[model samples]
Target chain A: MTLLEDILLLGLIVTAVAAPLCKRLMATVIVYMSFGLLMAVLWVLLESPDLAVTEAAVGVGVTTILFFLTLRRIHELKGTKDE
Target chain B: MSKKESAWTRFAAWVNGEHEPAESRLFSMGMGPRKERRPEITLPKREEKQRLHGFLSWYPVASAVIGVILVGILLATVLAMPSFGQVENPTNNEVPAHYLQHTREETGASNAVAGMILNYRGFDTFGESCVLFLAVSCVFILLLRDENNTSQKDLEQAQRREQRRKRRQDVILQEAARLLSPFILLFGAYMLLGGHHSPGGGFSGGAVLGGALILYASAFGQDAIRRFFNEKVYNTVRVIGLMLYAVLFGYYIFTGANGLENHIPLDYGGLILPIDIAVGLVVACTMYGFYAMFTRGEL
Candidate 1:
């Protein structure tokens, strides 16, 4: 593979590792969203703008917000103070 | 010669000194230095034998029947060889461009799909909205059991208990949520109203709005939001909206006058009917209903 492809693969791997390790739920969500955004850019690079738009809006935007909301609800139920 | 032979024998004995006698040849061959002997294979006998026999006899009978049936089906399918080549693709005769042009001119909706759904096939949309309303009502009833008697103070105490157990910092999240929720609501409304000309539609737009409310509740508290948009009022809005949509659809079906037929007399270009307004209301109410059911922890 080219240097650029190798670099992107490395970045993706780092993000994947970091997302799970992040202690805060919101930070984890943001990391996951960044992964999605990067994936959308990859889709755009592959010449499918429609899929890119859908991934950006539905995958990153709406889904991330949903995750954040769910996390908040869980925290509220458990009555645990944020670190 | 006898002395020389005795000396050679003594030398051989010394070379093999302190070595233990090897076991039987068969045992030695099977159980070598680092190797385990093969386990003995014995035929089952007596009571143990009967159990094996019982399992073997019954299992084969059941397996044989299933195997035979599956084989028969496979053979029949192979022999019948149903042809898929004879299947015909259905075609619509209406020219898409012409239909689109006519719909745009008649309804003045920039989007053809919206025009078709809201104006031409409005009955179907009404039914769909009614179904949504019914689902929301069912969810609301299930969640808000003993609705009239449950005092606000009781709900507040419950919320406080849940909050304490969770140990969440409500103030900080609440502040952030207060800042962000308005923008989310605005975006959702934009998607709902601009749906006639854009990619966003009722379902997605309603979800966005519902998501915004859920965010608000999570950040601040359900009690504060509930005070503004009460369960009964939301339910009423949902019912009224569905009824309005049904009435408009029935009007078109009975009177032959189109309900959302955009008659642009003046500068407004396309005039929206009570139908679109009803749809927006239903969407908003049903979304809120879902949020209430979800946040209230009933399911």
Candidate 2:
């Protein structure tokens, strides 16, 4: 990998690990989004445009929306003291 | 040494074409080279094993060490891989060439990937359709609330709260969603129906459709879309999509692709467009259903 690719990959790994470990639920969700974006970039770097498209669509788009929807539902019920 | 030869042989595993089903392998092959028993080691008693396990689990340092070792091994494997787009790479072989060269002529689809999914590996696409159908079913079963079990008073309270919540949501966002929703659905349809000649296919088009539906529902409230595409209507669409794919394949099996006399009888030669739409429908429903059931706990 080039220096740029290597740095991006390291950032990707950090985001992946940090997502679950993040204290705040919202922060965790944002970190997961960051991880997905990074993964899409990595897929592009690996010369798999189709995979990059899929990762962006499903991983970043649909999944993040799902997470946000769930979070909203939780906020509706619990009145958000922020988990 | 023979060990080196054996290692090289094992490394080129795909060259051996070990593509048989698991059951067939177990029955016919009789474990082949693995028939030789592994060296036996005596097992400790349960109490002793538990004590040892507890002792090992006491230190997080051991876990860290194991993780580092695993990373190191994986890094080595990555480093040893051939450079991307190299001529000598195993993936640079004949199979991809065959697909790329003959895809248009063989399948009537200009897009190689689309042709491959809907033609060459058509059955795999059929399986994917079923999987998407099953996914929606699972989510429905898990999240759909049992209406009869809930008290009438509780239901009224929930409905009142939902309406209050809906009123509180931003109208500007809803207006924007309203403006954009039709365009989104139109684009998704174009993607799905025109997939054979373009980059977009069922998966991407379905994702777009799902996004459009979600956007529309969020903007107009579930009641708006629900009026037209209620649960019964959505279920029918989903089932029809899956059934068409299944029936298409069944017809292919029964009469063959070119019909009984091995010649094109009617204009029903390529099923790529229909199959793509079918898969797209299932996927779109899956995404929409999961959202509906999860967020509202019913659909």
Candidate 3:
């Protein structure tokens, strides 16, 4: 791979590591979103635009929203427990 | 100066300290906390576990050793891989070459991936569709609210939500969605229909459509969505899509393979379009269904 591709892969790896290391779950979700975006770019670089499109649309868009919604529900559960 | 430019100029000047923020002008705010911070609720007595399990556990060291060994094995496997894009590699063998060579003539799709998913390896794609459907079904079974089980607590929660609903900023979002929804829907349709010729298909296009519905519901409220797409409608659409794939494929198995009885003089691409649409519908429903079920237990 070229230097650019190597850098992209490195960034992808860093994001994957950083996501689980994040204390706040929401921060982890944001890191995961960037990871998805990076993977999509890698797919494009590999010349599979179809997989890139699916990764961007489904992995980033739908999955992120679902995670956010689940996070909200978790907070609600915690609130109920406190009350 | 142009109106938009002047607006930006004023914003820049304010940020540059030409003007104080509006809140500062309105009220004198303090730098310190206004109230004592409440202690957050934490897991009760995790320190007890340290005593029970011992302070200096050997698990971490053992895990690290195992992890290193596993990583070494993984690295060895990676090093064993043939160099990228090498023609002599096993991956660049006959089967893929045949697929690439005759995809146009046999499958009639310009996009090889699309043809592969919809035509050649269609059963695997069907299984994936079933998996998504299964995910939705599992979500429904676990999280769906029972109509008859209305408690006093739920009633109170509903009332509290009603009070909160008044403060929701819907007008601006509604206006924006009105401007964008049509284009988003059109793009989704393009992705679905042009999938055969290009770099899109059922899953991606369905996600786009589902995302649009999510935006619309968020802007216009659940009741607005319920006016048309209720629980029954939602269930019916997805089930129909799943059933269509199952039934058609089963029929094709008996009628298609057997030459003794020929039904449709076969265009190889005949079932691909319908199957693609079926997968698209199921996927779109799964996406939207997950959002709806998770956010509000009611459909």
Q: Give lDDT tens digits, candidate 3, residues A1-83.
A: 68879999999989988998898888999999999999999999999988898899899989999988888777732343313
Name the better of 1 and 2 by TM-score. 2
Residue-by-residue lDDT tens digits, candidate 2, A1-83: 69879999899889978987888788898899999999989988887655776677678878988988888767842464332
Top candidate when judged by lDDT against the true structure: 3
CA-based DockQ, model 2: 0.45
RMSD of 3: 19.3
Off by over 4 Å in 3: A76-83, B1-64, B170-176, B257-269
Evaluate every candidate with DockQ and list the scores.
0.09, 0.45, 0.66
lDDT of each: 0.66, 0.78, 0.80
Error of 3 at B213 (Å): 1.3
Kindly give the stretch of ten consecutive residues in candidate 3 chain B with the minimal lDDT sum: B257-266
- Candidate ranking under DockQ, highest first, comes to 3, 2, 1
- Among these predicted structures, which one has the highest TM-score? 3
List clashing residue pairs in candidate 3: none
TM-score of 2: 0.75
Query: Which model scores highest in DockQ?
Result: 3
